[model samples]
Target: MTTDPQVVALPMGDLTFPADGAIFPGQTVVVVAYAVRHAGGVFLFDTGFREAAPGDDPELREYFQKYALRTRSLPDVLAAAGVDLGEITAVANCHLHFDHSGQNALFPGVPIYVQPAELAAVREPDYTLPEVYDFEGARFEQVAGDHEVAPGIRIFATPGHSPGHQSLVVETPDGPVLLAGQAVYTRGEWAGIPGALVGSSDTRPGADQAGYARSVARLKALNPRRVLFGHDRQGWPD
Candidate 1:
């Protein structure tokens, strides 16, 4: 506990769907909530699952067919991880995906950092559940670009999967750590798949494919010592 607590990955819930309707292993996603414990306080990155639940979006539920709509409580999950939710200083989301921002309502009046671009994107139909964010006393601190939210934590724009998608860069005692979010979908992508996204294209600026490439390249430029994800649940260190 002496060293700045390495970002803790909290398993919130699972998003599973028939991968191919064949005998192959079905695609199952474990949504993870990260807690970065700093000297100032515990800065939570992605607080959707307090207990466990499937996505609330109708289309997702109809297609996926399996997901817990809600979990216990954000505070309970934090407590189980030996983190007091009360000590939580602020919150941030990689994007406005339903699974990522489901439990944001837990922190009313608390400054929730999000990109203004994303805020605009979410207003469109079927983007995300509006109630999850537009709650009473909700305070959003719209950030435009890379910002140092804390002493050693910076949220950088990684837009690709979503226009406003962002990633966290935390300076741990070990080295720079990148919470890739969905910017880099899997470790395989980070490890360099031939068809994987690398950088943005000059032609299409915000296009999914090109934007994603640029975002990935931007993170790679940082040369983070450790990278985390929201869906990937594999062991980090072998």
Candidate 2:
């Protein structure tokens, strides 16, 4: 029998944005990641922010200084969920933004799944922190389209926020759970509630407004039992 995997939300701490004309100027939002524990192994989605350190690349230092990013201990967060660092078998990033793929280097020799376009975009100037993912032992498996990452776990392209952004669908015992990473800012945005606020791809920097709309519509068609956000601490179906 193929039993459903258990999904746990990993609290990655908070990010307080400075006024930059985006939806979250001067606002602090939660940084979250998810761990899917299956018979095969633990698959991680979105690896929080990279902590600032001395002697870091000048660009990296500047990036951290720019956002004033704060992050929780990855090991501690995983430990709280009964997971160990070495036990992580795979990684999948919704996109390669600094906040989403910062800790990817931690999982060396592990297959990190990502969209081809996302990978290419990350290489561009001011796209993301390259040092974060381009480290020794880093193994990237570019997934161009919908792929079965593991049993009952599927990742499909949901590009908008980034050229290759994707969302995850986990078939939990309760029902399908959608991990909408920055595809939509919050449940209000996903629900299409009028006057919902502007923090999603439609309003975020470097976003494709039309693509984002289509992506959100596609996600709605899935009819997930619960919807989760990368920045929102709350889950849908509340």
Candidate that would win on TM-score: 2
TM-scores, all candidates, are: 0.81, 0.93
- lDDT by residue (75-182, candidate 2, tens digit) is 889999899988899999888887888888798889999899998888777677678767789999988978999989999789888999999999887789999988
Candidate 2 residue pairs in backbone clash: none
**Residue 74 displacement (Å), model 2:** 0.9
Q: Model 1 over residues 1-238: C-alpha lDDT tens digits?
A: 5656568887776765355543113555567778998878888888764332364456645533544343436677778888887888899988887678878888888889999999998897756657655568888999998999998998989988788999999997778888877787656567765753322322233347777888888988987888888766642321
Residue range with the least summed lDDT across 10 consecutive positions in model 1: 196-205
In candidate 2, which residue ranges exceed 4 Å CA deviation?
Answer: 21-23, 193-197, 201-205
127 Cα displacement, candidate 1 (Å): 1.1
* lDDT scores of the candidates, listed in order: 0.74, 0.84
